[model samples]
Target: MSIDTAPEPGRTHDVRSADTDPDAGAVAFRPAFRAALDATAAAGVRVHEPGTEAYRRLSGTFNITKAVRPLAVVEPTTPDEVATVLRLAAVHGVQVAVAGTGHGATEQMDDAVLVHTCAFDELVVHPHERWARIGAGVRWDAVLEACAPHGLAGLCGSSTDVGVVGFLTGGGVGPVVRSAGLSSDSVRAFDVVTGDGVVRRASATENPELFWGLRGGKGSLGIVTAVEIDLLPIAQVLGGAIWFDGADLPAVLRTWSQWSSLLPDEGTTSVAIMRLPDMSGVPPVLAGRTTLCVRFAWTGDPEVGEEMIRAIRCVAAPLVDLVGPLPYRQLGAVHADPSDPMPVHEASTLLAAFDLDAADELVALAGDASGTPLVMVEVRQLGGALRTGPDCAFAHRDAAYQLFSIGIMVPEVAQGVVAATSRVHDGLRPWSRAGGLPNFCDQAGAERVRRAYPRGVEDRLARAARRYDPAGVLLAGRGLRTAADAVG
Candidate 1:
């Protein structure tokens, strides 16, 4: 959240000082400033400074490589406290960054106050209303566990460990996206603290413009404290994964590319070629070798679902076949996403299509004997209900598929991991779309902004950013400034 200088091109700064009026006078985090933040803690908040365990823990992020160290971290229990922090940052001319569970953290916050929403860990399910009101700090796992007993489902991505607010704000695409639509589509309302030190509620009828912007704008306009999300009545789904030996990759990829293109809206699917590490959480059968996994989730009748998946299972003798009727609460099993915090380099591209030629190129670049350093390469089937969501700031509804790659940044192969990711992606350039989802991609910059949103959409997001965050005191995260030159 450093604000001493304007953000350099392609670099992400968590916050920018509102006092950009060249004559506003330079500000620093002097002793009196530290004392003021500490004093505000008297009203249900705590300020932790550097070198302390609390500060380190609160300032940490899932991707260790992008870990940020702010001058101080503050945990506020109420939205008022959130407003107080923003107001003080505005007056004192300090920058502010927001953190929620640290899973989507993208860059360094060098020297500023980080507003961590850890203290807003509230969750209340209204069984009769068929919705849940959750705080920013709550993760999908908690929401899933809480709603399961009542036979309800909260749309969540492969990893339930990610924070609910962060996921929704970034236009959430989950395991059953084709059937359920984007996760952000389920949000009913939000309680937020704007950069002007005001608390506001946004919904379809209230602050309608802000509601549209907040859905896919990330933390640009405001820091969301809580949200009311509509839940699905789905109790279980026909879902899970089938794994095959990497030797069968070529056949598997070709079959998947053709099959996924024909999948109905009632069915959602994705395929991943994995090179699992031999670690505590890894199964011996999947460890230290390449494997191909076909994940599917069906929202319709079970018998038809099984019949639909038979085509994939028939492609090869599976190393592991776990696809079956599954409780919606256990959906994370489909992708088996990592739960631990670690360093990772990620990249993604949306595709106009994933035809046979695209499949062939992928196999040639990352086949079993290709000597690739990437840990995983995934292709998710997009479209169906995903393309029909209501008007909102979310973009790229016309993309037919999404290719995402992840490389663990272990020191020995960090450089190789990044390079190989590019090689594979560049090799498949023929079918590649020019943009990406804001939620995906390794780096945050102008390129990512252009990649995530079209000119018309980002223009609206930029306008909303300027309107809601007039002084630019909030973190213009996910390329807020790149779209709007008025921002710092």
Candidate 2:
């Protein structure tokens, strides 16, 4: 990881210096970045340079394959500090990138100043008002814990460890998404710092354009300091996973595809075909073998939910059935996503339909005997409240299903994983559409960013970006690139 030459004007460069000396490349822009660091330190902010241990530790991301090595990593404890860092970065002509838990890293950042928001860990739950104000660094698990005693729940993603602000900014889809809608739709307001070094409040009544873009535009528009979102009164839900042997995949999938389509707004479901490794945390029945898992989350009556779940259960004798009434605090169990961080390559697409023909194609590519190196292939049923949300930048609201695939980035299987995932993407092209969920768009570059929004939505986002981030220092998604090209 070395930056042997200085970057040309208007072009990005890798900030990491050579292996022989981590700070060797600092000679290019060290004077300016160091000056910014000194100024921030004088203001009581903690800043880490490239060669320091803090910089190495804070620069790492959850997706190991896309770990960032920025020129500096700044930890801001207050909104004012965040504004100061952005202002200095702008004046010095250094790019800026922000991260919470680093779960959504796409490896697009280079020659940049990394703003790590882990220090902004604030959570204020207003039970009577039915809302909560959360800091950018807060995780969903913390929110759940804070809201549990009041019998309220926030719209959270599958993994509890994911950052709350990052998830909401990307239009979070959770287990009860069909009933609760996206997390972004629940947002009441956002407190953020634009690239101009001003802290502003965005909501229906204040900075309305920024509000619309922040809901689904991701970090491209600004750096979020905190967010206020409405909470549901749901104390419990009937949800969890049902597992079956690989041999039952075909029968189970066919039944699930039809049954899930007819489910009411109270029911949200997804089916996953997994080939998990023989690891310690994995159950023996599913370890080192392909298995079928049907995940269900129901927000209605217990009896009705049980009756609905039984339809899929009768399709085949399940190896395990874990669905039952549980407190919303245990919602993470429904998806059972991995809690540990590891190198992974993930891709996703939205589907207009998943009929029998599509199912057959998917089976041929990822089923038990398919021999694909993918670790998990999942299809989540979408619609209901999700189809109708307030105006925002999130697109593909009409899509009926979302297909996601994940492959471990192990050296022995990396190439196989990439090729297999691409084949799966190609196999389902007929039933798939051009766009997908923003939270799941893990690839870098402008083309991928274009797919996250609908027609004309990207243009509107670009207009908003030009107005808020004229310097283009707060780069997050591809929308900013379009804005820079048009406005610069």
The per-prediction CA RMSD against the true structure, in angstroms, equals: 6.7, 4.8
What would you estimate as the lDDT of candidate 1?
A: 0.84
Best by lDDT: 2
Q: Write the per-residue lDDT of candidate 2 for residues 84-181, one digit (tens) a residue.
A: 88888788777788999889987466577888999889999999999999999999999999999999999999999999999998999999999999
- Local accuracy by lDDT, each model: 0.84, 0.86
What global local distance difference test value does model 2 have? 0.86
The candidate 1 region of ten consecutive residues with least summed lDDT is 20-29
For each candidate in turn, the TM-score is: 0.91, 0.94
TM-score of 1: 0.91
lDDT (C-alpha) at residue 248 in model 1: 95
Candidate 1: tens digits of C-alpha lDDT, residues 463-486: 887788877777554366666784
Scored by TM-score, the top model is: 2
- Angstrom error of the Cα, residue 220, model 1: value is 0.4
Provide the lDDT at 253 for model 2. Answer: 90
